[model samples]
Target: MQIEIVEVLDQERAMVAFNSPVGSAAGVWKGGQGLETGTHHVEFEIPDEVHSWSLVQPTHGAITGGGARGGDFVTVHGQVEGVGEDSVVTLRIGPDVIFVEMEDSVERLNQGDYVTFNSPTVEIYPYQT
Candidate 1:
């Protein structure tokens, strides 16, 4: 997994992007039709008081018999590095920390900021390469 700091929105908000090499293509196709290709963008907004954050990947559901069917869930963990003079902090996703820096700003963000990371349609196709 690789983490890239795309931009920092403020002391409390930052734009972080995540990319992981796809190890397999067993389920790369959606509805067993189209190819999936794209990097998953995960953004984080650290509160003024929070030094670290841990979030779980949201679940997807399918409708069956007029009801909803739920999918599996995964948990993702992250830590906070102190804000730098550039107002940007880069942290790695795996056990070892590799840094990537991006732009920074001071604008406030709402729930929309978090939703970007939880987008289910975003896909990555490794077999194409």
Candidate 2:
């Protein structure tokens, strides 16, 4: 699978639309930190495939100001079903993903440069084996 960049809103945020060769559908991502504030919209070309994707919420995780904690890591564990499709993915900040002490409209998330969300303080780390 491959993720293509459709648009970049700014240095902190971007608007990306994805395509999957396995299927003839597309997904769009909008809103995130350094961008605008509000309920960002993600329109899927295949509404029928909505259920095809799954969401993984963060388990027990923590982020600290100092490296003394070793490294701040958030694990979004879940499976992607539907066999084949270029999943146009988007990251949303629900109560489950946000800290109780966080009062920012945009919170930092753990997504890559291709992913987008409306959070001000997210640091994306790759999975290491």
Model 2 clash pairs are 32-117, 32-118, 106-119, 106-120, 107-119, 107-120, 108-121, 108-122, 109-122
Candidate 2: tens digits of C-alpha lDDT, residues 1-129: 222333332443332222222211112233334333222223222122222222234432222121111222211222211121243334322211321121222123224211111222232211212
Runs in model 2 deviating more than 4 A are: 1-34, 43-71, 80-129
* lDDT for 36 (candidate 2): 30
By TM-score, how accurate is candidate 2? 0.18
Report the error of model 2 at residue 42, Å.
Answer: 3.8
For model 1, the superposed segments whose C-alpha errors exceed 4 Å read 1-77, 106-129
What TM-score does each of the candidates earn?
0.22, 0.18
**Model 2 poorest ten-residue lDDT run:** 61-70
Residue 75 lDDT (model 2): 19
Residue 46 of candidate 2: its Cα lDDT? 16
* Residue-level lDDT tens digits of model 1 in 1-129: 222222221222211122333111111112223212344332222222222233334322111110011222112222333334443443323332322232423122222121111111222122221
Which lDDT value does model 1 have at 30?
Answer: 20
